[model samples]
Target: MVHHTMTTNSTSASRASSRISSMSRFLVLAAIVGMLAACGSVPLPPMEVAPPRPAAAAGTPTAPDDGAPLPGPIVQGRSRWQPVRWSELPGFDTDETYEAWNAWLKSCERAPAPFAALCPEVRRLSLASPQEQRAWMMQRLQPYRVEPLNGPAEGLLTGYYEPMLEASRRPTASQNVPLYRPPATLGSRRPWYTRQEIDTLPEARAALRGREIAYVADPLDALVLQIQGSGRVRIAEPDGSVRTVRLAFAGSNDQPYRSVGGWLLQQGLLRDASWPGIKAWAVQNPQRVNEMLWSNPRTVFFREEPLSEFDASFGPRGAQGVPLTPGRSIAVDKDSIPYGTPVWLVSQGPVTSLQRLVLAQDTGSAITGAVRADYFAGWGPEAGELAGRLKQPLRLWVLWPK
Candidate 1:
């Protein structure tokens, strides 16, 4: 009888211990959910922690680096983010990560809800060594391969930049092409005037009568400025004074954007359809310049902002409402990737080869689809030249806080 009693006690103790262990795990998971909820994170699904990858041999480049991979793919609006190893990223270690840090900091200014919690640590690591920063990233973040929901990972990478142009505060004989502010009726109208209508229709012109911000000499320059969304203009005031100002995207006519370059390509006017090629065609066919300009129905409006010394240091504010960093900012499909997400971008071609970190801090009308991106090339002639020529295949990976 005594022996039977002792056996029962042993079994009861084991059951009690098992209960305690289960409760501990529950409490830990509850705490995590609370933290995520407080930081405005999407409610996480039940997660299983995977084993960390084995460490590579020191000095052996053949072996892959160790990483803590997430359990499964994260489904987004227009894309799927499959968890990947840090080592899977091509040129992950080769990039000068410090160069991208400045852009990351800018993103923290208006950080996405998921990343807002990490801004403090991000700032702290501003002065940290690249190795230290990299280590922290591997420890605290999960890298996800950004892929289309229905197709392959490969996509397109184009380029854009801020144009610098000379302008007059008011209309001049030479500077006839005018850039305007948003029309008063912009909100009430679902689709506003087309580019040609605004130029020719008296009613449309009357709506934008007092909205002119500045005028430029070349009609093509005005179109380029509108296409870029923002630019720096050295304006000659009525007082014969000159001041450099930033013309920021205020609003746009709701008409769909039609690419002039694409139109030229369709017409088979010239083989090369880059901005330079378009200008060459314009020079040759000056009589048909208006015909070329009217091809794209969309018209973007702008508001002038004073370019202070501090403001001039960075590019204009992107869609995320933060000043974009040259070469580190990218315009992404918001449905595919959220603003303020740290993205690993890789592309290679004759124009350039890029494998580095960039932020999804902006979006463009043309930047649609799951894998597509528009690389922000900053401002000036060199930037414009690069922007005009870059169109290549791209791959992307996004980093999420662990």
Candidate 2:
């Protein structure tokens, strides 16, 4: 058995080393769409805001720890900041700042002049004590409160993870499903064959035939791969060896993406949009799988890459072109938060509650609005589960260099 683990975001996904169960197969779809909605082509407006609020009086740097009453909140469009001392960032003093330093370093790799210069301190502090790290942050960074645009300061949190799928290098009786690479003419063609056309039309099938990268046993795996934009396929070579390869996003058919879960929700087919609910519906209506697949005309294509040891640990490169750092990484609408900017996030949701610092390292199509974000929950089933379920009240404060 060939098992390939793939990591995905709004623009990526992954597969497990073992074949997922009937329900597990569909969960990948629910998780990816639930998190990203395939936000590859979507780009947010640039965050060309005026310079940030000047820092608090030097010695009076307000960053109180949690529970300390905040001064009047500073409202910014859809978000607001409560002036607080760095001590107010909940777990700031306790966070493994060095753990997030890697992500920071990765961001610095692409960060420009003003921000890039701060890399030295990030690297230097890795060797410093945690107390020293906290001090360094307090000296260099300013914390703010995350308030809502109108009502209470609350927001949702969701999660996504890399999935692993079993596959064969060549299609066979059981491994009938196929994942294809971008056709040479994909770019020249405006809107390529859609989900339905690609599945049924002989012409469409013929066009993509030779482009097959790998074949999976479950059709849902293939569908999830496309929706998430990238994933891993476990390939069984003729030599009796299993090698895992990533199906990174190449491009997509220009058609607008429609949500199958949303469709079922609107049609009243399923009361809940959770993966379990979607899977339950699928079990009763196996014959309508194609109908569901074709619900969204947009189809994605992939390009294969062999995962190196380092690449296996981190997620696929995000919008900022840096590898995601699990809990420390988040995808935000660039219009509200610039990439590489540090942020203090606070959210209390049914699944999780967090009041900590996270970086705006990525962006997604569905991640719009001034206060919206898609958190990178790390890898595997655990991350996918969290990301899939996270759609809760969220609030964020920019951690600008003071």
Candidate 3:
């Protein structure tokens, strides 16, 4: 029997790992249509004029944070920031500003140049009233409507979460699927062996000999763990002890990601390419499971990390190198919103409604576009359900210190 203890991390995998369940699996249809639509991608037009700036604070001006002169509207690779009034933000005054403070404080752990100077004040306000926090934000920062270079302010918002599973420290009859650490020859080639080659080629398997971190019962579970990039695994050890540990993204085979769900859809295998749907298909076509698994050439490797009482409270380190707050942390395209920036997000959809402050503390490969974001829904089955179904429209406003 596998022992069940739990640990976690807030690393890059949490941001990008849920691609399997979050969007790639469930939104396969959309992905197919998008691929068809992008066959003739063309250059975008120049950005438009900026909106009117918000009214200045009453007090006399002080030098901007970082001691740099306040620049005008900024343009990013895929997005543009157009100065706008605080009032322009939807439900801005009603959000529980203090709830977001924790995420902001985490961002300050590795705040970028523009926000590093503001961390002192951010820390001081941790205990301040919600009203006070909101006031400080308006007084010190300017709100910018984040829009695409040549598109609208609206974009896609998906969701991701850490997965928890059971395992064994060593291979067993049931737990035959092995999770691996990086191979010594991982980088010997431009891109390490593909997932199929790793399974069928003796040379590829030879390279990974003795690199097994743990073994699980189901190949699909291993695939899900790899997709999530980091997960909590309850392991039954040879010492007759069961403990939970985190599997973090150590490295990958360097192959481009290919969604198996999308591949299944393309093959006319299933219309509902969500995780459950894929699982059902696998059950029906047991002999072809490898064919489905191999659809994604990319194979991610992980290293085990000990989970502690305090560490369990937060998520794996994100791309920004900080533990992510469950509801308040977000993965944005760094080119659109730099890591550590505070963003005002507004989205209303069937699953939920959100009008609050979130931190740009993480990033994912699929989380591109100016207003696009991947909401971290936390861990466990409930979070998994939400992450699986959360695909919605979104708008964004970034707050920069004045």
TM-score of decoy 3: 0.83
Compose the digit string of candidate 2's lDDT tens values, residues 1-402: 011122222222211211111111144454544432222212222222223323443444333344745455556655666676654454554566666777888788888554777888787766765556656676676667555566544443444445667788887899978788777777766888788988788987877879988888876666655654555567898678999877666666766666666566556776545455566677889998778768878776667778898888776666677777878888776666777887877666466877666777766555556666777776556666666656556666787665
What lDDT score is found at residue 363 in candidate 1?
76
CA shift of 119, model 2, Å: 0.7
Task: Please give the TM-score that candidate 2 achieves against the real structure.
Answer: 0.78
Q: Write the per-residue lDDT of candidate 1 for residues 1-402, one digit (tens) a residue.
A: 000000011111100000000000012111111110000101212222334444433432232344433569999889999998887777776677788899999989888889999999899989876666666777678889888898555687766667788899898899978999889988887789898898899999999999988899888777667656778899999999999998887777767655565566567785545445566788999988888879878777777889999898888887787888889988888899998999988887667989898998877654667787777777887776666556567888899987
Top candidate on lDDT is 3
lDDT to native, each model: 0.69, 0.61, 0.71
TM-score of each: 0.81, 0.78, 0.83
Candidate 2 lDDT for residue 144:
71
Worst-scoring 10-residue span by lDDT in model 1: 16-25
TM-score leaderboard ranking: 3, 1, 2
In angstroms, the error of model 3 at 334 is 0.8
Candidate 3 lDDT, 1-402, residue by residue in tens: 000011111111212322221111123212112110011112322323334333334553322223344357889879999887665777775788898999999889888999999999999989976666777887789888898998544676766667788899999999989999989998799799999999999999999999999999888778766766677789999998999998877788877666666667678887645555666788899999999889778888887889999888877778888887888988888888998999998877676888889998877775778888878777777666666666667878899988
What pairs collide in candidate 1?
none
- Report the error of model 1 at residue 101, Å: 1.6
Question: lDDT: which is higher, 1 or 2?
Answer: 1
